[model samples]
Target: MSAFWRDSLAGLCALLIGIGIARFGYTPLIPVLIQHHWLDAGDAAYLGATNLAGYVGGSLLAAWLSRLVPVARLTRIAMIITTISLAACMLPWGFLWFAPWRFLTGFTGGLLMVAAVPLMLSRAPPHLHGRSNGIVFTGVGIGVIASGTLVPALASEGPAAIWGGMALVAGLLTLLTWPRWTPQPGDASPGTRGTTRAFTRPVAILLVAYMLDSAAFVPHTVFWADFIARGLHRGIEAGGFYWIFFGVGAMCGPVLAGFVAERFGFYRSVTGGYGIKAAFVALPILSQHPVALAASAVVVGAMTPGISALASGRVAELVGFAAHRQVWGWLTGGFAVASAVAGYLMSYLFDSYGSYYMLFGIGTVGLCIAMLLSVFVRNPPAPAAQAA
Candidate 1:
């Protein structure tokens, strides 16, 4: 009914289903797939790598295609394609079929992500940006949390049956959202040609920072469970609990970021956020206490997502919002490529070393670097000050 409520609900739905298919759907189904003897651990790991590679490729495709297609239509198509592709995970009897489906899911997911994430940032009023992103991005955490709860319960039902159910759910959400997709505000903003100077410096800096942040996060998400099991001397239950906390913390992050940044400066908050995460990530290697490990994980997850919220909002502030989706898409696609390669490299390092210490060390360096880079970021002077 109200604009705020309407916008929030609509944006939240898009993020929930789109990212649900791209990231969270496969994990819960893994146990079911494992139970069915459909995929081995190595097969699953490689498939995950393949899926991220596809994510990079898809982001590039979306950027190229963004210039040709209107942003909303492109996004609608991406979500629909992703919803269909997610069901592809069920098609395979083994890794053979599952792999490409995962790839396709990654592809559609990346396209929709760039389309969805930046637009949501730009459309919400300035004050609401952090809270809005927090609410919408919580969809990934919700989907992941749901997967953890649902998959084990459905383990007996098998992959095909579970896939059928999820596909139906996604289909319904997409149908519900078809008529209500919000108008992208680029039409109201100045066109980009006169704004080329606005984009060059900030975009260059954010692009690099995003890439480093991506590399930094890969280890935590990809190997947090392993780090606990090997270094912390914990079993699957402990690992599971740790990941759930991280997910819940991440889900709550946007709200916390918005609140804290409102009081403290955004740049200062982000630097501190990155610094805190780096410390938390390195904590397990320093000591193996279960409670300490879990606490660190919560901090790591909570602080990291908010860093992105702060960073993306900074871009919109610095760059101006004309065809913002296209600009951010180009920027995001670059970061996705880095993210994909960085993720693959992180996994490769873990396998080669048979330890997580090096991985954590690399992540620490990345955050420190990003924090140092933040110094170059300054808000443009007021319009009158520049005129003077």
Candidate 2:
């Protein structure tokens, strides 16, 4: 394979294992935990909150660690830790054990999220950066599909087996990408030390939009499967079934976003993505029709990572290659912090209200704000200058 494809594949696998399995695999398991009487709804929410908090830590750590260690080495270490954390969930430990393990998993996922894109983009040519980001984010959808479909099927074998199965998948992915984790001599090009400079208007707007997107995503990312299972009176399997649509949407979303970015510009593509996401966020609340919800799942799933891919590409476009890692890290860190806050807040709302309406309603508002914020983002330099 060419170096670009090799790097992209490795990055994709890294995200599939780290963010997909280690971080998001927990979403499908929440209903199972309740079904088995292993955790109540409140406890499940707390676990999600704790994991998001860890994600915040991991994002910041990746930024700081980038200065001290090679990003390639940090990514490899993060992937290994993420695998171990996923497997650790299989232990017969109580909620106390699960909480810490979940936190660790999120932390490792954060590291990979911040590090992996730079690793992949480092190998691509300038013009391919937009498409490269879309390709890398596709791994998250693949991982979501695995957890949403495979985990529920494995639920009959009990939590231990389900956890172990997910871990085994992560382990296998780890092995596949292990050799490529080592940094090639030119991977971290000279002058790529990310700047600590003040943000320009475009970067600032992008940051706010990213933060809003993070918050807007909480309801679906953490609770959609549960809503289908409990709120809609569908069985756990049915919830997982809907999540399959979500995965399918996500799988195709980034590619579409990349195509739009190539034509209309990344900033415009992301703005359009958030606008579409807002409508989908309100769909399940509007009707219980299976088709409507399925359509909602597909659109929301597409916009989730679709926005991320385009936004990250926009950041690189505004800041230049040298600052890509730093700017991306800051953007991701802000997003993670917002997600952690939203996770806990949504948990409280859920526990208090016992309904998904409020949760998704809030998400709709957040996405609208994100869409408006995204509209403010412009190319920091002239198109020709940015291209050069």
Candidate 3:
């Protein structure tokens, strides 16, 4: 097979193990953990925050290491670490162990995302970059679907069994991609920073918008399952069902975003996406009817990865490909910080007020602000001109 297919496959597997299983696996398992008395609501929030914090750390490290390590090696290491961390969560050692393990898993996710996303995009021919990114990120949805469907059934088996199962899946994916990760020749010099442009107004605006978009997603990613299962007194199975729809939306989000962005431009596509997402974010607050909630899941799920794919495309459009590796790291790190902050804040709100209304309200406001900011993002010059 061609290098393009191999790289894309490797990236998909990396994301599945990293973001899907390591970073997001915990969210679906929240209801199970709480029910099993393995963790309290507050502890769940703390664990989530800890994981995001580790993501921040790992992202920054990836940025610094981009010039030092090959993407293939970085990805391989991250996948292995993510697998180990997932297995570690299955240990009966309690929160002390769980916190570190979760953090480690998220750290690996951060590394994999920063390294693999741009790597995959860079490997694809320019015309296919947007779709390639969307395809790679689909792993997140696949992971979510697995967790949403598989974890609920495993809930009766206990946390150890559930976590162990996740580790096994991640390990298998890691092995599948392992042989193909041999270093590429001329994989860009480690230190070849993009001199095409510096951080300008548009880049700054895009980063802030991306950051807010990240924050806006916290309510759903961290708390949606818990909210349904615990907040609405819906059974875990119902919550899982909702989460499955969420994953389904995510699975398709990138492809839709890619098509729209290619036609309408990334700026318009992102603005419209955020607008739709913001509306859905407010849905549960207005009405928790099963239909409204389900719609909310589908819309929000689509936008989560959709926005990500669009944002990266926009970044590449603005900064040029040579700069993508470094810039992508900062963008992802900013998102991680936002996610961490939102996780802690929402966790506190849940503990103090026992409601998600305020969280969704805040998220809606943030998304609106992001949409407004996106309007200012002008299309950059053609890639050849930008690279020149």
Give the Cα-based TM-score of candidate 3 against the true structure. Answer: 0.94
TM-score of each: 0.83, 0.94, 0.94
Q: Write the per-residue lDDT of candidate 2 for residues 180-266, one digit (tens) a residue.
A: 788777776223343545267778888988899899989988999999999888888988888888888888888998788889987
Candidate 1 vs candidate 3, lDDT winner: 3
lDDT computed for candidate 1 = 0.65
Candidate 3 residue pairs in backbone clash = none
Candidate 3 displacement at residue 26 in angstroms? 0.9
Candidate numbers sorted by lDDT from highest down:
2, 3, 1
lDDT (Cα, 0-100) at 31 in candidate 1? 35
In order, the Cα lDDT scores of the candidates are 0.65, 0.83, 0.83
